[model samples]
Target: MLDLTAPSFMRAPHEQLVRALDRSCFAETRIILFGKVKLVLGHPEIQDMLKDGGRFAVDARNAGHASPFGMKFLPASLRVLSDNLLALDDPRHRELRHMVDGPFRRIQIEQLAPSIRETADQLVDDMIRDGENDIVAGLCRELPLQVIFDLLGFSDETRGKLHDVMKGVAGGGSAFDVVRAIFRLKPAQAALRREFENVRSHPRPGLVSELANAGGDGGQMSDDELLAMVFVLFVAGHETTSHLLSTATYTLLMQPGAAYQFRRLGREARLVAIDELLRYCSPVQMTKPRHARRDMEFHGQSLKEGERVMGLLAAGNLDSRVFRNPTQLDLARRPNRHLGWGGGPHMCLGLHLARTEVLEALSVLFDRFQELALDTAPDNLRWTKRTGLRGLKALPLRLQ
Candidate 1:
């Protein structure tokens, strides 16, 4: 078993992990036991496995250990929250997926595109006025959190509370950070629960309200389910995008020529560049793990039942065979199919929101801040130690 506690992957550029996976692939390796659990990194084998969900299950309980969030706090509807789409297998998965996927329908998210762009623009204007700033704190973090709060119909006061909760939860320190963050969220969770109770009488026109009131033949969302969804959206929506924006900013600053090209090429060009950035940074390095139900062969290796599979999305994004010169950041590359937001039925539900946010933020940053430069060496910036997250702790910048 690889000692994950050794901090082997920590501090190293994400490339090191990709290289490790690549080597393992050529060696026809399997079962990389990191801290007792084996992580399957080979893409071709993983893709084939994920494709056949019948044999290779994605169900939560059957999949693996309890969710990190669940480990922190048990909600009223623990079963529903745990067994929701992401935690279910096959036919059962399809049922819950239909409900959650309803709101994220392309048409629904597309309608919200204008709102997303406006939010990005407004935040950028503030950044430009501030002169020098930490884009992560200033623009990247605020924009997505605000958008998700708005979608949940959270009042500004409640939104402020949520921000504090997220900061305390995601910021620094040891396991105590989780305790602190959870304490901060308690009040907000109570407020949200109250709102959920009153939701039927006075439904609001946001995603949370929609899920709260989803009924009849189609909707499977329970009150507890709605609360869990809100918490997930509030956290993941902003955190992942924050890293994306920060990393993309760092990438562009490093490659001025590419940044200039992205700005000059217009909307379509900017979109293409954003796609590449998503692939390159792949903000969420690891995903919630999936467990194997029965003994199976993966990449010519036999695996026994009761084992887990953690998808290394970063590894897939940097696969040398799939992406030419995968290490280099190429904004102009076409046919980019990065697994940044993920794939299959459990792909990121807020992908449209995320894509729109990245596009607008990049456009505004490059267009307005022509003199943007890194205030510190990118190498000097420390990456967050969290295994599943890839982002800088501090991104100091000078905007003249």
Candidate 2:
């Protein structure tokens, strides 16, 4: 069994697992679940797995068994957060996606760009005034949290309340991890349930009203589904992006030439540079477990029906077959249609907004402090020890 908690593994699983990846396109990993499941490591193979919704299922019901995302350990009371898009397929997935995805479309999020930049600037200003060096708390966490809360029309008090709970979220999907997350979420779920009702009675700005009034779009999403959507939106909205912003900053600072190169780019070019960083750092290390729809031969491996498979997004990002010098950080690399943000039908729902926030956050940080540098030694920095995610615990910086 792979010891997920092993210090060496937690510190750098990719490096340790690289051999398995190099040896074969498909391997077995018990790190994520109780039973060993297929781990897709190659770039092309992972892409095929993610895109072939017919062959692979995010909702395990479509396969054969019922492996809902933590459904067994997940409490009924908290079904509100677990029964949403991540656990659905086909018409239902598309329907639920269409319901709330309106506000997140690039054109729509573009309208929020000005506000996003303002929030990024305000966060930077606050950090400077407080003489803060940790960019993770100063900006990475706050930028996305503020943006998502703003979209949800949440009050400052509510934002503060949920922020505390979300910040402490434990990542592995073990039974223990699931049980622990449930208790922490109950309070926040109740609070969100209230907000959903509030929006229904009185219209408000942002997605809260948009979703609370989703019935206007000729569909009725149940309360549990709605709650899951809202909560997932809130959590997913910030978590990965927070990591992306922090890790991107750390990567750039460590590579001064890359930092200098990024700074020279205009808005358009900076967006391109963001993709390269996304490819290099790969904030999301793995994807939700994908179940095989039926017994099939893939990349020479015989997969049984209902067998769980995981896409190693981080590993695929390092595939030499696709990316030249895959291990090296190249901020200017183009033709970079990497799985950093994900691919296919189930790609990140907030990709547009996330890209915009990370881009603006990076731009503001670099522009404000032309002499920015790491305040601490690289080895001393902390990283979040979570399965399927990559991020910094804190990114201390020096602004001169």
Candidate 3:
């Protein structure tokens, strides 16, 4: 019944700009159209709609857009991955949050500081050793995946399957892609399931093992649960970070003075630059479509129950009211309230970890790679087809 011949949902630069302009206007328009989906863009009244949980919900089920594989697979696969925290609301979200929050503490991540830097250094070294290459494949993609793999205690033996699963989940939006994604994940899941079962009886010192053996009120995750969380974390966590790093690096490479300014600032200052890049790139340009659970008043419009809303995170970050000269990319934008990570209870659980990864990775690049430049013409670059995640698929570069 689905039209396979229909062109996949791809947004052109102009279309992206148009949607952006609509949001920048700062008017409360409930039914602004976006390709096929109607969105609620830039409603100040929605401020309460976001923080007030009981009214607006993150249920993507009714939104019915076919892009997010996680939303569609919620009944099957994502329920497990989301088990630890992201899926729950209210007391449950708080209860589960308290237990796992300890592991992601600044001190705990700080302890992994050496490991994080080592991963970035090794990846950069490898890239330098191998002259011209797709930076995404050689550099951007490997860093976070390695950190997460090491953290989860997955073996080098399973790296192939791990990569395959990530690819499948990330591109599992269209009908053509869905079949391929499902095929890709089936074998990967079987392998992970076997490993998880093996580890349950004999625990290891990794995050997966900890989750498997964890007890107390937080409730230990089931095998499916473990695999799903690991799956999402490995894919979503690294993929977005990869985008931020690649796009930020590319932006600086394109702009002469920006990279120089960024480098001179040192680690703490570069972190601020990275934060601006996150807002500027808005890699996860859009978030899950939120639907109203009840009649909600937002930015002057009255929305009846069941109306769908897509929060334009990039637009929200660029609103002139919140950010001065909203279009300009000033790395030192103080009090930057960008929602690079979404807000509310369902805010990205791995945000701190992600911040650490991006900051560390960018720090290394600025330090090691001098006179970094693109190997090809700007027109040759190809943007990825993901509606939610904005990034370059391949970045051919030369390091001096």
Candidate 4:
């Protein structure tokens, strides 16, 4: 059994376990995440399972079972988060995805390139003025949060409130901490509901306004679902991209050859480099748990209906059969079908925006500073303990 929740794996993922499972697509192995489940690490098999909505489902209801999470105990404010597109089955998921998909399309996101770069330059200027060194705190976290807040049309006050609320919510560790967090979140929850209503009557300039008015052929989402949708947007929109920025920058600092090649590439080639960077350090280590829709064998393994299986995306990225020299950071790697941003219907909606941010961020950064290097030793660098995401706690760099 692999305890992924352990501090060791959180600090830095070792590839030995993945190497051990190289002979098979998947093993009937025990792994603890939400609970014990079968783990898949092969690239082809995992990607296939992810794309096969008929065979596997994110919603347990589609598999004829109640949600395994004891979510009923949670307040409606919190419970509504589970009503997101990620938790829905076909038709509904497809519909919701299509409704919210307009703003995130590559063309729409590309229009924001100048503003994104402007924000990046401003952040860089702040870093230089303040003599800030921790890239995670100084640039990685702030840039994405600022961009998302701007995109959502959130006022500065709302951004501050939401920041505190999110910190309070995610900071909890024990039962006492959980109780404290719920109390802290109560006021913010009510305020956000009112904000959503305001968006309906008085339009805003961003995605929030469009989504607030959105009603596909299936009809409008309820207040709770709307809140959940926005919540998903706020969290997913910034969080994963921050990690991507942090880790990708760190990878570049670590590999000079890769960075050199990355710098020499054209715009299209640079985006490809970003794709390779995503695979090299998977922002999300694994896809959310998927359940079997029926009693069936998968890739030679037998199973029961509604059984849990986790796709180890990072390990899958390292599959030697799919990626040549899987461990090496090849900036020009072609046919990079790595599941870094995930794949299929549930693939990241903000991928275009994310790629834009990275491209502009790195371009402005390197173009500004001629010399950049890590301030702390690689061994001293820390990783976030939060499961499912891989990112640096800080990247202290000495730049000139």
Compare the candidates by lDDT and give the number of the best one.
Answer: 2
Put down candidate 3 lDDT per residue, 293-317, tens digits, no spaces: 6776766666666556566566666
Q: RMSD to the native, candidate 2? A: 2.5
Candidate 4: residue pairs that collide: none
Question: For model 3, where is the 10-residue window of minimal lDDT?
Answer: 1-10
Highest TM-score against the true fold, candidate: 2
Q: Which candidate, 1 or 4, would have the higher TM-score against the true structure?
A: 4
Error of 4 at 339 (Å): 0.6
Candidate 1: which stretches are off by over 4 Å? 1-15, 26-34, 63-85, 90-92, 127-132, 170-176, 218-220
**Model 1 residue 355 lDDT?**
76
TM, every model? 0.85, 0.92, 0.84, 0.91
Per-model RMSD to reference: 3.9, 2.5, 5.0, 2.8
Model 2 ranges off by over 4 Å: 1-18, 32-35, 170-179, 216-218
- Clash pairs for candidate 3: 81-228, 81-229
| Model 2 Cα lDDT, one tens digit per residue, 275-365 | 8888877788777888888999988999898888888888888888898887777777888968987777778899999999999999888
State the local distance difference test value for candidate 2. Answer: 0.78
Give the least accurate 10-residue stretch of model 1, judged by summed lDDT: 26-35
Show model 3 residue runs off by greater than 4 Å. Answer: 1-35, 43-47, 60-87, 171-179
lDDT string, candidate 4, 366-399, tens digits:
6676576789888887776555667777888886
